[model samples]
Target: MSLARFLIVLWVCLVSAALPLNAQQQTEQNQPMQLMDGPMDNMLPIEGQRFRIDADIEEITLLFFREPNSQPLILIKPDGSKWYDSDYPLERVTWYTDPNFDMIKIVDPEPGPWQVAGRVDKQNKAIIVSEVRFEAEPLPKQLFQNERLKVEGTLYNGTTPVSTARFRETVVLDVLFVSSNNPDFDNFGADPTRVAEFSDNGQGHDEQAGDGVFTGRFALDVVPGEYLPTYQLETPLYERSFEDEAVVVEHQPVTIDFQLAEERGADNGIEVSLDEKLVNPSSVAINGSVSYPNGEERRFSVTKIDSFPHVIPLDNLAYGKHLVELTVFATSNQGREFELQFNNLSFISVEPVAEPTAEELAQQARQEAVRKAELERQQREAEEQQLIVNLIIVAAVNVVLIAGAISFVWWRRRSKRLNNDPATAQKNAEKAEQKAQKKAQKKAAKSE
Candidate 1:
């Protein structure tokens, strides 16, 4: 049968068993019998197909597992009366049937041997419920994310533990973390989460099987928030649930901060800080791999730490986005040690702006001097070219003036030679006088 169906059957059985018994019988047994001595002894041994119930039991729940499609089992009461599913007394008897099991709850049941007539499974068990309750330790007021805890609980009938080996086989113990929905907390409006199930099979966190002390290993891996823990114990015939006090699950106690290199050729710094109020700083160790932007990765471990803000230096890291993945092993102030993982931690490294060094400044100064010298040389060459052009102009002017003076002197010497020669001078004067007479003749003709 499914665990859900079993839990339903158990709940119905418990509710039916809780109904009041006969008034006279209740008055006689004013106080319920205290079965607080040892492992549950209320269950009597089965002989053949019959089991006996004691007279002290005001309510009894009997469960029988049958083969598939088998006929409904017939219950033969202590008075030799037969009771079937259709013919049980409505007020005092409740019967439930399924394909694999039949559950019967009897209130103020007759104290005697009852017989079952049908094909019953060999492993069928009879569970008696008397003041059944589930008891567990209250969760701590504060918890940390990724914390693992071992919690123990016990199923009791009055003051005695339910130690039936066969009962454990059919019982289911579960723990659920329900959000407290406090607006002031992080888990407000969060859905309920089933974190762990209790086990008694000597597995994981359980020390022994069928010892009635159920153990559950709870891993607080859910979101850090306020929650109310509920522990439930379920059996084929009854279920008991207990709600623990509210608890706040704080964030992981360790945090990581990356400080990029401030200057060229400087080492990058990773500062790991821990909450001393929650964990012991001296007991913490961090180890992880750093993936640089260039796809190169280096692994490192930090131990023997005795102070807060444990700094780890990463040298020669490239500039760009860098990924840091780490795992922290820390012991809490409460002395509970746990391991936490931090993935997806990353930071960007930018190249630093550095000032020019003295050598670089000197080189710049030398370059400037060379540039100035080149400019001066170009200016000097231009000045020399201008001086040469000025000299050529002066020389050309002086040559022209000297040539004119020579020409004037030659003309004066020629005139003097003409005067020295009479024939030449007389021929020159006659030519001048004949030219003047022709001009006079032309002027007189024009007047006429």
Candidate 2:
């Protein structure tokens, strides 16, 4: 047969043999072993094949199946005593078998292939797997790269493998870039070809399979500069990878592995962040740099402020209330002065180069008051003069009217004499004579 055909045949045989053995072992584990119909002496089934229990009349019997180099199995009694398929290792046998070939013992051991042993009590009532156990170990890390990256690994406990345990893997890249001074660095700075490719292989790593092996990769077009790559593995049962010693990817590929271990202590120092939430005009979230005494630059934020007094609502400030004096203060008080012509409907706070001089401010104030008072006094004096002029005009008009009345009287008498008919003049004289006679009579009575 061809090499491929031969390998296929070998695999099939192994699977078939292993499966039946597992089933039989499981069945024997579920019940007490009993006689199968006929009476038999020292003969029992092992992996569906017959085996002879070496006659140690003490506590247990053993079942052994050999398939190439596989570990020998031993089944034991219901009393919890152990027996080994091979006598070489005395303490290793944990499971027991009965006459009917039922399993009366069970053991929670490390993950791996297990052996079976049997025992006969004085009455042969029960059997158990009491002694040996196996253990499994974690799988090794496998790395692969395609258009993206792929990673694969298994989880095990000692020699046995655990099924269906949740595992998570994460990958992150600290991007690298070439300096402008580099010889190959072109003046045309941003080259799309040199940019890193993108990948979403679940947090920059690989896909996980039902078998607990993770496999996938991230797409990255690494630039012509230094960069770092890291991966984290986590599970409820185990923790691996030291956070401090993160994977460093400078210019080359590095193989990284992780194992579950105990947790490390956390950071102790406080973290300071800078924000620029409150600034003028365009109140926005801005990133600013904080300078240390040595001129080290760090990011920070400066929030917005109220007008006039230039007060900031520092109520929620992390460090509590603080007196932050904004220099060049202006726009308040009697001698108030501002550096710039601000026309905010509300009061605005502007940084001034220097405060207004006291003399200039006082002089301006006095001038304004004086000008207002002079305007009022002028208005009052003008009103009073107008009243006096109106009174004099009234008196002159009265005197002129009285003089005109006298002239009118003289003109009327003369005109009446000239223009009046004789009869009309005689009537007027008669009325006047009557008026005089009445007045003369009153005067004589007063004299008496």
Candidate 3:
């Protein structure tokens, strides 16, 4: 087959194998990755099959598809100078060849018609390099969790905006929040989070389609912490990434406190407080819905705040948990305005206990009086019993004393009668004299 026919068949086969039908439709516009129409039109003139390189282009790369094992490509510059594959290692030129294609890169290329003299397939492309850039607005300094922001960016090719709709379709711009690894922040060691993807499809946050301005709807719903906002632009041929300075996402600026009704059937109140250090109190506006346990919802809005700790009164309070969903719009203390969402705010309401009636109090008093009288009667009976026990003890002691005295007197009289008896006295004296004679006989025997 002819080289062009072979290249066309190969291209079709490669595309068919790589993508499904629906994806092919979506990618048809992007197939000529970074191949601008002006350059392509100027390069492919009617006179001959040659490409052009403009003077302003700092560098250009040419891709030529050829049959496997084909001879190396031959490039003819505008000055009729020829550069061969063997002429590699030359300054400002790089040539690489594979089984299917040859890629040549030239720096400061001559600005005129250039031709490839070889049996190269018709599927060739020229890419302008080192001139494509993505420029974006700097992320705000004071960002809050759950804040939605619209950031705009533009793709530039050598100071010219890449506004072609087909070219825009080939570009993918994404924003990622990579943890700054600052120990002072909450997101330290956290995985990188993709927060937004830029689009030019005139969809959410995008003002218009293919106007060259790419809009990124950033939902800062990540944990309040430090992050390095990184932007990446990717196309089928090349990719570029940029990192902005680190930013800290502050905590939500609105806090809620519920002041439930003091008594049952009374209105409940909610106190909304704003962080004055982060947000302006007067500029804060709250719009929310209260979902009650009984499946009823009430919407409220507070546009004017007369003072701090603004109170919102809630009527027909429910007896169970009530959920509060709020969207706060406020200007930061630095004058940057933003909106925040607080979905999980909630509180509970309870019923109060009732007081007793007058009749119940009177009955309690009567019961106390009867209890006091019974206690007095029981105390008197206990005192009488204790008195009788003490008297019995005293009487028993007296009887024992009287018996002891009578016994002592009778013994004394008996002793006096015995002393007056002479025979008893003489017998006592004779026993004493016998004990003394025995002691004197022992003394005399010790002397002998």
Q: Compare the candidates by TM-score and give the number of the best one.
A: 1
User: Could you give candidate 3's per-residue lDDT for residues 257-314 as a string of tens digits?
Assistant: 8898877678888888877888878898889899898999999998999887888988
lDDT of 3: 0.79
Top candidate on lDDT is 1
Q: Please identify model 2 stretches exceeding 4 Å from their true place.
A: 1-357, 365-384, 411-448
lDDT (C-alpha) at residue 239 in model 3 = 76
- lDDT of each residue in 72-134, candidate 2, tens digit only: 345433334444533323343243222333332222222223334333222222211112111
User: Which model, 1 or 2, shows the larger lDDT?
Assistant: 1
User: Against the hidden reference, what TM-scores do the models get?
Assistant: 0.51, 0.18, 0.51
Indicate the residue-level lDDT of 439 in model 3: 99
Which window of 10 residues has the lowest lDDT sum in candidate 3?
40-49
Q: What is candidate 3's TM-score against the reference? A: 0.51
Off by over 4 Å in 1: 1-41, 52-58, 63-74, 79-103, 108-112, 118-125, 256-273, 285-329, 334-448
Query: Candidate 3: where is the Cα deviation over 4 Å?
Result: 1-132, 157-159, 236-239, 317-321, 348-448
For model 2, the local distance difference test gives 0.35
Worst 10 residues of 1 by lDDT: 29-38
The candidate 2 region of ten consecutive residues with least summed lDDT is: 339-348
Higher-lDDT candidate among 2 and 3?
Answer: 3
